[model samples]
Target: MSIHLVTGAGSGIGAAVARRLLERGDELWLLARDAGRAKALAAGFPGARTLVGDLAEPSRLSWALGHQAPPDRLDSLLHIAGVVELGDIGDLTPKVWNETLAVNLVGPAELTRLFLPQLRLSRGHVVFVNSGAGLDAHAQWGPYAASKHGLKALADALRREEHPGGLRVTSVFPGRTATPMQAKVHQQEGKRYDAERWIAPESVATTVLTAIDLPQDAEITDLTVRPGR
Candidate 1:
């Protein structure tokens, strides 16, 4: 069975993706800020492992994942953890910007780097769960948009650097989804939080699984999933 590592496994898209992978009997290593939630989610999968820590701080990753032995190869790496803070440029503070970047961009970059050796051995796929904001910034999405933009750049660079080695890198840019983060965004925008108006996390997970299931010789470099208009 293929082995995958998924971050942000506590809820929303991350959890959905993790569940899908486990359903297929693929082994999973999940990382989340909520240890209890992670453990609970992995309870049904005997091959699943969970780690708890702030992924934004890469220094804590070692300790968080220390309980399990390092794998000789990793089939996939899914960077799904992210933080969103809504505010216009003038209203946003440096702390908000820093936190956003740390969680969305820097942390994933380091985690990918750390897993490179194993990935290289398996010629694995790396997928980043980006947002539509990464393509165009909205009035109050400065910090989050900037971080996603940076994440896009990171994915691009990784694809270029690893393509020759048979490592596939994909960036999945999805529009607003029915997630807790989207609820917060809607609240800040003074808009009603309507789940029907957004894409389902399961839909995004389906897209991700599609990318992972593609022929080994083919690569889906970029994927964009949005709600039907």
Candidate 2:
């Protein structure tokens, strides 16, 4: 059976992806910060495994990667854990800036590094859940935008470097998905951002599954999924 590891598997797109993969008869390992949430999610799936650790912590992530019976090869690594901090330049603080970068860019980068061996062993694929902000900058989204931009560049560079080894890397940019993150951003703005009109997390999850299911000889490279007006 194909073994897929997904971060941020406790909710939203991650949860949907986990369920979809399970339905397809794939073994899934979900990583999340909240043990309770992870357990709850795992319970919903008969054989799925859940690991609790903060991806932002290098030591914890390293331990999780090392101790796990390194899958003969990981079929896919979905780096989906991320955070968005919305604020103007004046409202930005060091803590908020660093937290956003840590979760959105640094953690994924570090996790990829630690899992490179397993990925190479399986010649597996890596998928990044990026955002539209990664492609275009908007006012008051400086930190979030910058982090996603870095993530996009990182994914591209990794893809190029690993192509010879058969490891495919894809960065997906989804525009305004109706996930908890969107709710948080909307709350910060004190208004809804056309929530009903936005794309659903399930749609984004389908895009991710598509990227993973592509033929080994092909790579999706970069894909952008957006809601139609």
Candidate 3:
């Protein structure tokens, strides 16, 4: 069985992906900021491990990855943890911009870099759970949109760099998923956002698993999953 590591495993797409991996009989390592939530979610799985820390913290990420006995060189690393903050351009602050970029781009990139040796050894795949915002722009989503755009570029560039080394990368751009993040956006906008009718966390998880299962010779460079009208 292959070993998989997933970030943002406390809830939403991250939780769904962890469950899917467990159901497939793969060993799973769940990284989340909440110790209780991570432990609770990992309770039922036989080979699941939970690491609690903020992904935005470089030292925490390093400690989590190296503190424990490393699992048999991960077969897959899913960068599913992210932060979404909605606000008009006028509302943008240094703190908001920094936090958004830290969780959505910097942290994921640093974590991937730290794990490159293990990934190269296994010839594994890296999946970035990006958003439609990464491809297109939306009003009042300045920080989130910019961060995702940066992440998309990072994923594409990494894929190109690792192609000859047998590493595959996929950027999964999902639109308006039904999650707490969506609720936060709607609340911030003070209006109803109907895009929620299309994307579900489980559906995104399925797409992610499909990308993970593809043959090494084939690659789905970027995937866009949107809700159909």
Candidate 4:
């Protein structure tokens, strides 16, 4: 069975992806921000392993992961954890921009760098669960969009640089999914929240799995998932 280290496995697309991986007998590692969250994820995913690393503080990630015992054979590293606080560019503060970039972009970059040896050893995939904002920025999405846009660049550069080594990199841009994050976005937008109106987290999970499961002879560099209905 392939092994994977997943971030944001507590809920939404990350949870869906973790569940699917566990159901299929893959060795799964869930990255939790704290001991309490790690315990919770361990309880939620019975056979899966848990690692403590706070993505919000990217600078401390190396030290944190160093203390934890991560998987030795990693087939993929799934970057799905993210936070958002919607505000117009003019109204947003430096703290907002810093925190958003720290969690969404810098954290993922550091985590990937730390795991590069293992990933290179296995020719593994690195999947970034980015948002449509990565492609197009809109009002009140400055910080989040900027971070995702940087993520796209990260994935692109990594793919090109690692191509000779057979490492795969994919950026999955999912449109408003029915996630707690999406609900919060709606709240920030002062709009009605309807789970049915957005893409299901499971659908995005499927897209992620498909990208990772693709044959070694081919690669899906980028994928976009939008709501069907």
Identify the leading candidate in terms of TM-score: 4
TM-score per candidate = 0.93, 0.93, 0.92, 0.99
lDDT tens readout by residue for model 2, 1-229: 7899898776778878988999989988887676677778678767888766676665567776555554456889999888877889897999988888888888888878877888999899999999999999898899999999999999999988999999999999999988888888888888867678899889999999899998887889999999976
Kindly report which residue pairs in candidate 3 clash with one another.
none
Summarize candidate 4's per-residue lDDT along 29-142 as a digit string, tens digits.
999999999999999999999999999898999999888777787899999999999998889999999999999999999999999999999999999999999999998899
Q: TM-score of model 2 relative to the true fold?
A: 0.93
C-alpha lDDT of residue 28 in model 3: 90
lDDT tens digits, residue span 1-229, model 1: 9999898776789989988998888988887666676667577445788666566776776676566566668999999988898987998889998888989988898788878999999999999999999899988889999999999999999999999999999999999898998898888889899988999999999999999989998999889888985
Tens digits of per-residue lDDT for model 3, 4-69 = 989877678888898889888898987766667666757755579876657667557777767666
Off by over 4 Å in 2: 64-72
The per-model lDDT (C-alpha) reads 0.87, 0.86, 0.86, 0.95
Better of 1 and 2 by lDDT: 1
In model 2, pairs of residues that clash are none
RMSD of 1: 1.8
Per lDDT, the best of the predicted structures is: 4
Clashes of 1: 0
- Model 3: weakest 10-residue lDDT segment is 63-72
